[model samples]
Target: MLPADTESESYRFYKSLNEDILLKPNEFNEWDMQFENGDVVNVTGYESLQNAICIAIMTRFKELKNPLYADFGCRIHELIKANKSRMVEYKIELFITEVLTNMRRVKKINWIKVTDNPNNEFFKYLVEFSVTSIYDKIVEGEVNL
Candidate 1:
């Protein structure tokens, strides 16, 4: 992996795309994307698209976009939007349940540890690691997916 200060053209591009989509009014279609069209608008709430962005990043890093992961990302966004601003104590359990419920619709999730204790640091680490991988994965794609 490159150092933090290392400048990656891919990173810059993803950062720009992330900024664009996050700020776009309504859902912007990929086919209609224009880089120099407008200044970005500020975004307020976290939406399902954000989860899609994260998943896109991860799949991009893998240099391969799996249909499953794409579906997983969309599912993430749906689950997230459905459950807004719950207490911190219940957040992990709710997130796990959401993951399991959605995964059951397709395939069983390979990794799950929150059933024992939702607040476990390991579970937190797993989620964070996956999300961060998405960022790196985006860089790997070197193109918007």
Candidate 2:
């Protein structure tokens, strides 16, 4: 369970999307501040959750340079790079479940839907899922890869 302070707060601390900087709320216009500082603007609530899920799914495990960030991603990318087979889909489902559930903010993953994209020249899948946050907020999102 999330602490009462986290659950009740209107804004949550998150890293910038493009840069490794933290965003904090203040009396000054936050959006302008981000642009002025050359940091990606912050996201809130469902958008924040969706971004996190997308990042986890898209990133390959151990792809990051820092060893401490080694476990922050899923193995879905490996499956995508492998030969197309039924087993790949099954592995994707399992990987998604494991990665999403392990996230600090994700309380539970309701389901993950993987669909084949035959026409896409690069990506072979369209992955979708619904997740319930530790704060009890349910949000659904999709990612193509």
Candidate 3:
């Protein structure tokens, strides 16, 4: 957990892992709820850093088709939806690299692997990547589309 004073200053200060409230008090509201045991939950430190990276990879960019929201998600999903050839795999890897390196907390992206899900008719992909955070912490995870 981050110190209360620096909670707002650090991008890694996410909502408590066990609580719905944001780490920063000013960002909290009545809508946020607490656990029955009164435990404050937030994804701080390495967890928050890793979650941010995962969200960026999973999200599609510029999803204009949905009328409700525009400019959301990454293009990798669109490429998969189009049923592109093997080259799409390379593109997904590049996109993940581009997105992660651009983030302030992401120091470097070690590697990215994009594999097709043969069982899925939609050409879904299984994404796995490792990144070095600014704090020198290495985080890695896989996302299945």
Candidate 4:
């Protein structure tokens, strides 16, 4: 097969994954991706693109369901909702730091220190910042700050 065909197949395989699994926030979301001929691959293969996007999102959700220490903080929402009483405040940053601490099995002070001056209100601001960063990073591959 031609080199282009091989590349096309590779794209198709990855693209098919999104379709079969239905991952959201699809490959069209990748700003860095470009086409020499200026034809967008993700937009062209629309149905499979949608599926691939959904699958990708579901995979991320699964990872969040049970995460490593670093990732647990990133997925605090899932954890708190799972065990509300265990999370005292249920505010976002509090939830993030708590879940991260539990996953690490570390003292709260350490996580707080890493988070920078972790007061309750300050932590709330940090939570908003982190969420915004995640969205920006995913959509544009650049965190706002």
The prediction achieving the highest TM-score against the true structure is 2
Runs of candidate 2 with Cα error greater than 4 angstroms are 1-39, 118-123
Q: Write the per-residue lDDT of candidate 4 for residues 20-122, one digit (tens) a residue.
A: 2222233334323334454433431233432322232223233645445234224333443343332333443454444433321122222221232235433
Q: What's the lDDT for all of these models?
A: 0.31, 0.66, 0.60, 0.30
Mark the regions of model 3 whose C-alpha exceeds 4 Å error after superposition.
1-41, 62-73, 118-122
Which residue segments of model 1 deviate by more than 4 Å?
A: 1-64, 73-86, 105-145
Over 26-123, each residue of candidate 2 has an lDDT whose tens digit, in order, gives 44313122333444555555566776777777678878888778688898777645886668878888899988977887888888998776456444
What does each candidate score in C-alpha RMSD?
13.5, 8.9, 9.0, 13.0
> Residues 68-118, candidate 1, lDDT per residue (tens digit)?
554442222223334333343245444544543443221323333223222
TM-score of each prediction: 0.21, 0.68, 0.61, 0.21
Can you list the residue pairs that collide in candidate 2?
A: none
Could you give candidate 3's per-residue lDDT for residues 55-144 as a string of tens digits?
Answer: 655567764477654644566666755556678788888777777766777778888888777457454677888888776768887666
- Native-referenced Cα lDDT, model 2: 0.66
Lowest summed lDDT across 10 adjacent residues in model 3 is found at: 17-26
At residue 49, what lDDT does model 2 achieve?
74
Compared with the true structure, model 2 gives a TM-score of 0.68
Name the Cα RMSD for model 3. 9.0
Best by lDDT: 2
Greater-TM-score candidate between 2 and 3: 2
